[model samples]
Target: MLEIRPSCERCDKDLDPLSDGAMICTYECTWCRDCAEVLGSCPNCGGEMVQRPIPSAARLAQDPPSTVRVFNPDLMAPTSD
Candidate 1:
């Protein structure tokens, strides 16, 4: 099951599970559309960035989104290779 993370890992922006602004990598690293555009890929794993699936309101009600926020300042820096 997808963690459906609650915020953008890069900018710390609130990302509702139902919002289309959220992007994710295969490893489930979450980011907002803006940050994802700037990055063009996942910094941690070098994986492609894609849109995150939006869960239905009913499904979201049953399985709440993760409240845990992963903010890494180092991740914001540009990486080589």
Candidate 2:
């Protein structure tokens, strides 16, 4: 089952389970569409970003979305070699 993470990993924006603005990578790293557009790809993994599917209300009721927030601001921070 897709984890349906609650917020964007990059910007910490709240992404409701029913929100169409939620974007995710193959690894299930979630992000908002705006951040995904600006980054052009997943920062955690060099994978394509695609709109996440909104689960049906019934499904949501059966299997609730994750409440955990994953914020890693330094995931994209500049690294000195």
| lDDT top scorer | 2
Model 1: lDDT equals: 0.89
Question: Alpha carbon lDDT of residue 67, candidate 2?
Answer: 94
What digit string (tens of lDDT, one per residue) describes model 2 on residues 1-81? 789999999879999999999999999999999888888878778999999999999999999999999998875565444
lDDT of each structure?
A: 0.89, 0.90
Candidate 1 C-alpha lDDT tens digits along 1-81 = 689988899889999888999999999999999999988888889999999998888888888889999877676777566
Off by over 4 Å in 2: 75-81
- Model 2 reaches what TM-score against the true structure? 0.89
